[model samples]
Target: MNYIKNMEQEKALFLANEVTVQAGQIVSKTLAQNPHVSITLFAFGKGEEISSHDSSGDAMVLVLEGTGQFTVDGSEYVLGVGESLIMPAKKPHAVFAKEAFKMLLTVVFPSAT
Candidate 1:
């Protein structure tokens, strides 16, 4: 099945809105979902953060707006809009929004056991 659409209507699910996180508020949305991939959009309020955790599969984070820091295995890396980071399976990682920011998070999981 083809899910592609024209740019005009594509903005429907790609818009931003407020979301609440442990540290603060954020604006986010989910763009796509399939058996193999899931993509979500995030807009984090300043100081917002996600606690460190490990994933069962590989994941990718693409910064879409503002600034923030991502920690992988205890090492911190500054990130800005247009930047992307990859997290391998079982590695501990987290993200903190230094300022209100937007991002796209994509995760690819292993086939069902």
Candidate 2:
């Protein structure tokens, strides 16, 4: 079974180029998704944002290009190219793009009882 989709197999590729930033919008490419984990790529236009929300999984983000602002539990952080951050599960978090940027987001969910 293919655990990953929307990408080529056995190829060398840059993650940042997987998605393109569109003016006034956010674009996402989900490479893998299951109950245990989710891997996604995102490109955000300048001033685009994702409103605050909580997740049931711990989310990690790696900046592939440009800059992004992350707010976790009311604290703010600005990340540039190659930077990464983790947002703990159950804590509120939000993401904003100060300029056009691309990122890889991996979320690991808790196991079911």
Candidate 3:
């Protein structure tokens, strides 16, 4: 089974170019998903946002291009290219596009034993 999908394997490529930002939309591409972990790529148009929510797993976001605003437990943070942040599990977090941006998100869940 392919744990990672929607992307080429063993080839040179830019993670930022894996997805695209639309005029007024949020686009996402899931690279891997399972009970243990999830990896995804996102492209957001200016003004786009993901409303506040809590997750069962810790989530990390890496900025690939442009700028993004992250709200974690009501605290706001701005991130630019090559920056990263981790949203602790069960913490209310949200993401917004300060400008058109791309990001890689990885979440790791506790073992489902």
Which is superior by lDDT, 1 or 2?
2
Which pairs in model 3 have colliding backbones?
Answer: none
What is the per-residue lDDT of model 3 for residues 1-113, given as tens digits with 9 covering 90 to 100? 66899998889999999999997999999999999999999999999999999999999999999999999999999999999999999999999998999999999998887
If ranked by TM-score, best first, what sequence of candidates would result?
Answer: 2, 3, 1
Leading candidate by TM-score:
2
The C-alpha TM-scores of every prediction are 0.76, 0.98, 0.97
Q: Which regions of candidate 3 deviate over 4 angstroms?
A: none
Stretches > 4 Å off in candidate 2 = none
The global C-alpha lDDT for each of the candidates, from Candidate 1 onward, is 0.75, 0.97, 0.96
Local error of candidate 3 at 87, Å?
A: 0.1
Alpha carbon deviation, residue 82, candidate 1 (Å): 1.0
lDDT of 2 by residue, 1-113 (tens): 78999999999999998999999999999999999999999999999999999999999999999999999999999999999999999999999999999999999999999
What is the alpha-carbon lDDT of model 3 when measured against the actual structure? 0.96
| lDDT top scorer | 2
Q: Which ten residues in a row have the lowest lDDT in candidate 1?
A: 14-23
Clashes of each: 1, 0, 0
